[model samples]
Each structure stands twice: as C-alpha cells, then as structure tokens.
Target: MADKKIWQELCSMVHPGHVFQDEPLGKYTFTKTGGKADFLVFPESFEEVQKTVQYAVANDIPYTILGNGSNLIIKDGGIRGIVLILTKLTKISLQGSEITAQSGAAIIDVSRYALKAKLTGLEFACGIPGSVGGALYMNAGAYGGEIKDVLSRAVVLTKTGQLKHLEKEDLYFHYRKSSIAENGEIVLEGVFSLEPGDVQKIKARMDELTFLRESKQPLEYPSCGSVFKRPPGYFAGKLIQDSGLQGTQIGGVQVSTKHAGFMVNVGGGTATDYMNLIKHVQKTVKQKFGVDLETEVKIIGEDLKKQES
Candidate 1:
C-alpha cells in the first residue's frame, strides 16, 4: 500500500525501531483513550525531528507534534500521516540561574531541577503534569506562576521545517494560550530564567503546592488535566459543581467526585465517551449559569464513523 511505503521511508529517517505503524495512541496519553497513529515516530535528537518534519512536508503528509499528552484528547479514529512524539528528547541543563530543557523534559522534572539549583520562580510548576514544550505551547500554569512568567526564549521548528528562535515577546502569551499554538510551531527546547533563592524556602513552597495538587486533583485515575478554562470571572470547577454535574458518567468515564473539573476514566473509556461528557457538561453549565464554558484541553485526530465513511 502507499501508506506502507511512506512509513517505511519514515523508518529510514528515524531508526526503524523507533518508527511504529498503527500505534495505539492511548498508551502514551494521560487519558488512556484514543485510537491509533498511522505512523508514530519518536525522534531522539533535534536533527531527527528536523528530518522527520522535512520528509513529511516534502511528501505532503500531515504530521503532528505531541509532548507528554497531559492535556489532550485524540479522537477514536486515530490520526493520519506522521505523529511525532518527542518523549525521547528529554534533556535538561542549567547555567547561571537559567534552565534549558528539551521539549520532552517533563515540566515537573524541570521544576525539581530548578529547586535543586536553588531557583525560586518555578516552584509553582513543581506539580504541573506536562512537558516543557506543552507548558510553553499552552503557557501552562498552576498555583500563581505560569511558563510565560519565566520563559526567556524558545527554539521551535516551524511547520515548513525551518528552525526559529522565539523570545518571550515573540510568543505573545495570554491566559492558557500562546503564539506557538496559533502558528503551529513545534517546540524543540525552552530556556527559563529564574531568580536565585533560599533552598529551604523553595522546597517548602514546592511541597505545599504538591500537597494542594494531590489533595485537589483526582490523581488515582487516568484523566485529562483541567477540562475547561476559567470563564471570565468564574472558576470552571465551581461552575460545574454548581451545575451539579459531578459523579456524572458516560460510557466508562465519570466526572470526578473529588474534582469537579476533571473527568476520569473509571475503567475502559473511549474518546467518544469523553467528548460526549464534555458536551453534556458544557450544555448543562450554559443552561444553568448563562456562561459559555470553553475547553482548555486540546482534542484532535478523527472519529471512527468519519474514518469508516
């Protein structure tokens, strides 16, 4: 088949072992849902990523870059073309109150590294469950700090496979959104500038935030983190709770009783189930409060029905 030939060529670009065909995407996502990727490639280095992108562009094959998959939902029909997961690019280093992390480096690990270096600003990120790239793409934040507050610069690969360096000003960060998402840029690495602080104080702050996150979030089950963005003056969780949508279940997914904002996979949930539940919540909350709930989570891929068609 034509698809087989293209993926075989992809294997030549990345190592054959790292290239997978019809790879189930659920195994890599936080939600433990989704169907498959036609071709999944894990590139270990920046150059590998470049080659993959160039190839995809030249061949006119659609490609997507994924980091950690902490705040995403891929639909049930899986994705077509190449799906590049940057998990193998995990690398972190520090120099002169700055931390440089590869896109695949967990934002949580980067925060810990900052702590070890006696850095202060990233303490708020001590519990964010996302990759550095994902954090930058969405301007990820928790407690009182956000990626945009500390991000000095980022190296991104443009959709055309050109490498570009973007400063903080170039990113144009806003509440839970960034220029990266708008331009469809793939983050290769991020440099964060932090202030030097007392080690004991930094550790204490991280510990406090960690405790708050664990106590407030449903960490025991697989769930997409933070289903909806804050709607203007009101909190998404509070709106959902007031709507009395907690403990609502569709298929195997349930709105967490512990956290009104998170929808957890109690057992074998599907992307269809998640999507239907999200719509239900949005509709219910809108009907009750007259506030439109917007999702913070990114959903992609295709539907099984669409694929069959």
Candidate 2:
C-alpha cells in the first residue's frame, strides 16, 4: 500500500473519487479473477494522465499502465505502487478519411465508427475486444488486417511525462509485439488513415467476421481470450485440441471445450488456477508435439504465497 502522505498527494492530482486505495482489480479485468491494486487512478483526460505520471516519477514510485484489461491476468497478491487505468480517456473524431481515437476508446467501437463513416480498412477490427491503446501496444490484428496497415501515427507520453508524436515507421510492429514497452512510452491516442468505401460492403465483412468469432471462440465464458501465440506452421488451438486437452480443468478454470485456445473461469477461478493450467497445457503440448507454445496474454503481479510471506 502507498504511504498515507503519498496517497493524499495522489488524490490531490486528480478527482479524489477517482483515486481508489486497495481497489479490487478483478472487478476491472475481463477474466474477473485477480486481486487488489494498492492505488488505482482513472484519469479522465490526457493532461490528467501526464500530471499523475509526473507525480509518480517525481516521488520515485513505480507505476503500471493498464488499458481495458481485456487480454491480461493480474496475480493473487495484486500490484504494488500505482496503476493507471485509461478507460476514462475515451474520445474519437473523424476528419476527412482519417479517424483519430483516444487510446482508451475500444477498438471494436472504433471499427464500427469507421464503418459508420464509410471507411474500409478498419473492418477487420470490428470484433476485437481490446482498447485502442492495447491494440497499438501489441499491433493487434484479426482476419488478416493489423494496426500497422492503417495506423498513420500515435501520440504517446514518455517516462518523463513529455508527449511525442510517432509516425508508423517508428512503431516497429510485429506479430503481437511493438516497441511501446521497450521505449517506456504510454499511448495517448492513435490516428488511423483510412479511405472512403461502400458502407454495405464494410458491414458485410464485419458481420461475417463476428459470426466466425462467435462460433469459434469461447465467448460465453469469462476468459483472457486467445491464450497463446500461434507457433510457426501450427495453430495453438489445433495443437491443444489434437493433444486431447479440451475440457481440462485446474480448480475452477478450464480449457474451454468450445475453443482449446481459451481458458475460462467457470466459477470461482483464481489467477493461480489460470497460471497452473497454462503451464500444464504448455508442458502437455510440448511433450506431445515438440512445439513450444508461447503465451500471448500478459500476466503480472505477485502470488499469494509471496505476499503472505
């Protein structure tokens, strides 16, 4: 937990009501299975984010940047220091064929917005559940289109709380990877350069992708979405399915029978259950096929055992 003096100073930086102490992180995550956050601040504007970050840096406090918590798992003991959740900073605008979205805005919503504006290129993101910030962080893609294909530039805050505008070439995007972390930059907004197209055509494509996603993904359960990255020449889900690991359960978490790629929290699942199940799947799959499955989901925080000790 943050010291009382530090907590008071943080609360003064933003809306006091937005500064939560010992906040339960599970309530914010898609998996609904994490622990608490020592300090969680929901900044409503870019300026607020800058101020909070500057305050943390000046005080020598560690801080973590959190998006919408869609593809993440927080551990049982929770995070120390401060966590800044950017969901409240959502805003989107359109100028000519270009669409600019604040980092916290949902990617799915941005895609729909693009379609509504008769834009063509963003149709592939119509069903993605992560925020624009999260998407840019991982260069998120689906159905053969990716952020790198349409992204013109991004506005980010450096570790020193200074804002920088970076062109697409500076991003260095790859499959589920970007230079965001290595550069210690916090994404503020994304500017996508799109083109005018037939709305009906775009809608049809989005609808088709949505149907395929609903049919193939385990959307009915609370999960972290696709658990592992696709290995070269092999699909993670297919390999796990071929290994006969579907319906496997560790505590209340289960490898979904619907989609082998997902591990769902059927009921009272914990982060430990999720971690254990992931290790088991990797071990089983590697032993069976000699292919190493690397996780795509971001897992953080401390375990209960370490916290108690």
Candidate 3:
C-alpha cells in the first residue's frame, strides 16, 4: 500500500471524488483480470495531471500513466504507488483541416469527428479501441494507415514534469513502437493534420474497416486487441493458427478460435493464466516456425505469490 500521508497529499492536488484507494484494476482494464491499485487518481484537466505527476516525483512515490487500459495487463498482486487515469481529460477541438485532441480522447471518437469534418486520413482508426495517447504511444495503425501518417505534432510531459512539443520526426514511429515508449514521456495532446475529402468516401472507408474488424476479430469476448507484435514477414495470427494453437486454453483464458492472435478471458481468467498461455504460444511458434513472437501488450505490476513469498 502507498503511504497514507502521500495519498492525502495527492488527494488535495485533484478535485474531490477523483482519488481512490485500493481500487480494483480489473474494472478499468479490457481483460477484467487485474488485482488492485494502491491509489488511483482520475485527473479532469491537464493541470491536474501535471500537479499529480509533479507531486509524485517530488515526494518520490512511484507513478504510472494509464490511458484507456485497452492494451495492458496488470498482475494479480496489483500496482504500487499512484496510478493516474486520463479518461476525464477528454477535450477535442477542430481547426480547419486539423484536429487537436487531448490524450484521453478515444481514437475511435477522433476518427468519427474527422469523418464528420470530412477529413480523409483518420478513416483507418475508426475501429481502434484505444485512447489518443495510447495510439500515439505505440504508433497504432490498422488497414494500411497509422498515426505517423497523419500526426503533425504532440505536446508531451516529460518524466521530469516539463512540457515539450514534439514534431512528427521526433516521434520516431515504426511498427507498433515509438520514441515516447522509449523516453517514458506522457502525451498530453496531439494535433493531427488531415486533408479535405469527400464525406461519402470517408464514411464508406470507415464502414468497410469496421465491418472487416467485426467479421474477423473476437470482439464478443474480453481480451486485449492483439497480443503479439507482427513479425517481420509473418502475421502473428497466421503463425499461431498454423501452429494449431487456436482455441487452446490455459485455465480460463483461451487463444481465440476466431483470431489466434488474441488471448481471451472466457469467464474467470487471471493474469497468470494469460501470461502462461502467451509463453506457451511463443514456445510452440518458435519451435515450429523458428520465428520469435514479441508481445505488444504492456504487462505491469507485481505477482500475488511474490508478495506472499
């Protein structure tokens, strides 16, 4: 557990009703299998986020930035120190052909806003179930389009709590990885430059992508979108499928029969179940295909038994 005095100090920095103690993390994550957080703070504004982070740094309390929790797996022993959630910092604005959105804004909603504004470039992100910060954090892409294709610049909060504006080149985006991941900077907002396009055409593209996603993905169950990064010349799903690992279950978690890339929580899965299954798939795929698979999902927090031991 975090220090009570530090928790009190953090609570004073944010608005009333924003701080929670011993909060269950499963309620916030997509997999619904995490333990708890020592302290969870949902900041409503950028200033609140800055204040919280600054205080945590000055006080020497460990801190973490949590976006929509779509591509993360928290362990059963839970996270220590402060966990900041940016869901309430959702503010978006449109300036002519460009859209500026806060990090907490959902990428899907941003794509919809762009579509309504007749913007052409964000059509591929209409089905991505992550926030703007998370999308930018990993250079998220789909259907041949990526954040690197449209993002002009972003405002970031460094680990030292200083703000900086980073251009597209500074982002260093590539294949589900970004400089932000390496630098540990917190994305505050992004300005996406788009082009004027036919509204009907943009809508058509979004609809097509949405249909394709729904048809193929196991959206019915609880799981992170994709568990592994795409290998250089092979698709993660095809590799797992060809290995005959589809529908394989470890405890309550199963490799999706619909898409082998996904590990789904059927009913009562735990993080251990998911991790064990991921290792099993990696070992099997490496043995059969000689290609190593890397995880795209962010896994954090300690293990329950580790604390007990």
Question: Per-residue lDDT for 31-113 in model 2, tens only?
Answer: 99888888999999999999999988888888989999999999999998889999997899999999999999999999999
Top of the candidates by TM-score? 1
lDDT of 3 by residue, 44-127 (tens): 988888898898888888899999999999999889889999999789999999999999999999999999898889999999
Task: List the lowest-lDDT window of 10 residues for candidate 3.
Answer: 1-10
lDDT of 1 by residue, 106-218 (tens): 99999999999999899999899999999999999999788999999999999989999999999999999999999999999999999999999999999999999999999
Each model's TM-score?
Answer: 0.99, 0.98, 0.98
How many pairs collide in each candidate, listed in order? 0, 0, 0
In model 1, which runs have C-alpha deviations exceeding 4 angstroms? none
| Per-candidate local distance difference test | 0.95, 0.93, 0.93
Q: Give the TM-score of candidate 2.
A: 0.98
Query: After superposition on all CA atoms, what RMSD does each candidate show versus the true structure?
Result: 0.8, 1.1, 1.1
Off by over 4 Å in 2: none
Clashing pairs in 1: none
Best by lDDT: 1
Query: lDDT of model 3 at residue 308?
Result: 65
